[model samples]
Target: EDVHIRREVNALYVYAFCLPSCREYLSGSKGEGFLFPWSDLDIMVSKLPPEEISMESFHNDCAYIATTNGCKPGFCKLIQSYAKCDYYSRVEFLQLKQHAGFNVNFDQTIRGPCYSTNFPDGFDCCYALPVHPDSSNVFLRTFKTKFWNGVKLEIMNKNITVMHCVPKGPEKGDDDGHQWLISFSILEQNIVHSLNHVQF
Candidate 1:
């Protein structure tokens, strides 16, 4: 029990994000498939890049580059860690942790509700789907979408419907002849706080 609680606390510190690269909005634009320009941010404490697999080689290479103009050991460590830890973890970990980055656009006008729909014409969209670092946690963050119609979209990777209610026979691949149907689940109470009590 102690081990489980410790692990949960550690996992809470790990941060993940999908920050937009540009402020420009692509939802209502004339673009066909490109959703928006954004850079996904996912932070995790993990291993180094394969190229820098050995700890010795990484420090040696980075140290040599840094030494050119009176560089310090800490500077070398920063560069080495950034490439080895930051870059590699974000790209590789996501591949294993979440679904592959998708090429899609949420243009409801052209593509309708089918997220798997292909890119129309030559235009393309970039999707950054993040999976929880801790698989044991039942919480999953759906896709982050910004719509032109003021309706934001968050898609859950899990089959469990966070949305209020799924349509009749949603599993058997039935369209129900309706192009658009939206479901929303409302949580009654959301609170975060500390529990303090005297025992023992």
Candidate 2:
């Protein structure tokens, strides 16, 4: 219990230093304040020029059309809708560039959407695009379900702004570079935070 408290305090301390405008988030076990000897940190970093979920047009170079073509359930391919810029040509390169600012020594392997690092401690840093729940039909349907009725109002009233979609390819798809996985890290964190000690 002492370790858990320490970890929570440390997380809060680190969060305090983040600029209000920054879109970085600490997630997984670390964000939930559960630390064991084997705990690994999970960090989600939101990308700039947020991509819109549009099927008709691409407003800018950063815009992409999220399609489920050639992907498994819960995965989608972010097909570039406009002419690609040199900097944001590929998802892999963009994610790598985003994670390069971290001080840790990362492993060569890319695990899903995150870059894994073993230096100092194990870390999985994922670069993602933020999407609002209001804009997503799936999210809207989910919130209306009976399971969410108990805490629906509380969740809606929370300060949560966005959920993330990580840049990762489907397991069996040839277009591995354009695949993205929808992530509910922020919502999961909120649920965990709302739990009582016994429920947790």
lDDT per model vs. reference: 0.23, 0.59
lDDT tens string, model 2, 1-200?
Answer: 76467556855765686554346677776666666678898888775444544322344433566656556777666655565532222466555564665545635347767777786577887777765434443454456444443454555555244456677656675443655676677766656555655775
Per-model TM-score, in order, reads 0.16, 0.69
Residue-wise lDDT of candidate 1 within 53-112, one digit each (tens)? Answer: 112233432211111122222111112333433212222323332243342333322122
Q: For candidate 2, what's the RMSD?
A: 4.5
Winner by lDDT: 2
The alpha-carbon lDDT assigned to residue 162 of candidate 2 equals 49
Query: Which window of ten consecutive residues has the lowest lDDT sum in model 1?
Result: 186-195
